[model samples]
Target: MKATTLITVLLGTGSLLGLAGCADPVPEEPVPAPIPSVTPAPMPPKTPLQASHALFDETNLRTSNTVPTGGAAFLAGLEAAGFAADTLETTTDLTSVGLKAPSIQFAALVDSTCLIGQYGPGDTGYRSVIVAPLVTGGCLVGESHR
Candidate 1:
């Protein structure tokens, strides 16, 4: 081989070996620990009044009134919340029944005990049979007994 060619071949080999020697031993990075899948706690069940609030948009029955507006506001609230308005059956005597949707029966009796209105010892001006939402199942459709 020619001298120049021989030198060129040696130089090429030297350059290749020099580049190979420059290779770094790749350091393995530490893998981050996997985060555990955290499930959130379920919400607690709502009470009758709370459930009513959630289902209805408004309540006409004033808990403090001696004679609530025949629970009109309360019934309206129930409809707003999501219950079927017609499914709720009510009477002035506080004996009301509702077809609790999805499979549940609801009955509520509004009497002196279930009265939403308040009264003083001598005050009898507002003695109404108010129809209020059932404390347990669904909407409330009621009327005034007075």
Candidate 2:
């Protein structure tokens, strides 16, 4: 009887050990971090004169199709933008030699800068508009007409 009881106890212990070894292990999952959001700043619009100056620079005046041709309207626009009008001259002298149409030269001085614009006769529009720093009196090249 004692042998039988010892045998039964041993069998019970072996079964428990086998069951533990055959069980599968569960792995723990990792947590993810949250991301942050950001916003950009706004910019201001350019003034009339500033816009005009930018257009002139971008187009180089010679190749631009947007610049206004010479007339009362052109002078008025410049004057309204705080530019002091000089004089309007009608001549082909200031224009490129290839263009036979007489051009009207429009000149203005604003904030120590001289703006010279040349427009062809009729509806031919602008030939060029040059911006230069003012010297002792005015722009060295675009100031006078001869």
Candidate 3:
């Protein structure tokens, strides 16, 4: 080929090569808005009650109890009070006791008051199991339902 023709071809190829090296121009996505920091609310204080206070009652005890009705939060408080993590059991049969221990079987009332369990059968009705502070935890000793 002629010198001029060859020079033109080389210039065209160089220009094409230079264009290929350039980055693609694309509009970037907008950055997402930053999430607001969350400050968790302080936990409420837990009140440990008597073992009898933890029993199952039909009326007053039920009102003051915090176990069955308080849901998981209440159970958590029990654990905080030293109840074992593996000991908690949920129930549906209302007549079928709610919570128990080796020495005590009881039902919750409202917040942390009423507890109804077995001392025996007849005349020996309700029994109270002592539950110390969340520090001492709950010590259960007795025969539970099979």
Candidate 4:
């Protein structure tokens, strides 16, 4: 409202606006570069030998103490793991005298190899072997239950 005071305020405001343009620029932080995307390589298929052992272990034959050793569950496990039913040979769960056998022998014929496996009542564990097919065009010998 006072003439001299008003002029002084205007000069101060104008001087600040003029100095603002001459001020130093603010610094900016540097940004990191983006990472490149990667595609993983596909895994190779498991060999028949590996598959046979995997099937045996996956079915829990190593620790199975009951009839599953020579029972349908064991065979079903093999079949479910891509072993054809026709390619499997197994021994009878019961002996000739109608008793549980000490152990059961089974085989899964894959390609030209037969993965022979055995599991008993107290099998510490069972490991399958990769062997050639029998002369009879099957994996097992003597009388097999299929």
> What is the lDDT of every predicted structure here?
0.42, 0.53, 0.42, 0.74
- lDDT by residue (64-87, candidate 3, tens digit) is 244343224334444455554454
Compose the digit string of candidate 2's lDDT tens values, residues 23-82: 987766866667666566666788655765664433334332434443444555555554
Best by TM-score: 4
Better of 1 and 4 by lDDT: 4
For all predictions, the C-alpha RMSD in Å is: 16.5, 11.9, 15.5, 10.3
**Candidates 3 and 4 compared by TM-score, better number:** 4
- Name the lDDT value of residue 132 in candidate 3: 33
Please provide, for model 4 over 1-146, each residue's C-alpha lDDT reduced to its tens digit, 9 standing for 90 to 100.
59999999999999999999899988788788898898888888997668666776666463354444555656776777677898878878888899887877788787778878877654445655778897888988777866
Q: Which segments of candidate 4 are over 4 A away from where they belong?
A: 1-48, 60-68
Count the clashes in each prediction. Answer: 11, 0, 22, 0
Q: What's the residue-level lDDT of 92 in candidate 2?
A: 38
- Model 4: which ten-residue window has the lowest total lDDT? 60-69
**Model 4, residue 85: C-alpha shift (Å):** 0.9
The 10-residue segment with the lowest total lDDT in model 1: 100-109
Model 3 ranges off by over 4 Å = 1-27, 50-112, 117-146
**Candidate 3 Cα deviation (angstroms), residue 114:** 2.8
Reference-based TM-score, model 1: 0.26
Model 1 agreement with the true structure over 27-138: per-residue lDDT tens digits: 8998999999999999989866555433232232232233443344344443554555554333342334643222111222322122233222233422333344556433
Best by lDDT: 4
- Model 2 off-target regions past 4 Å? 1-44, 47-77, 80-82, 86-101, 122-124, 127-130, 134-136, 140-146
Supply candidate 1's per-residue lDDT for 145: 21
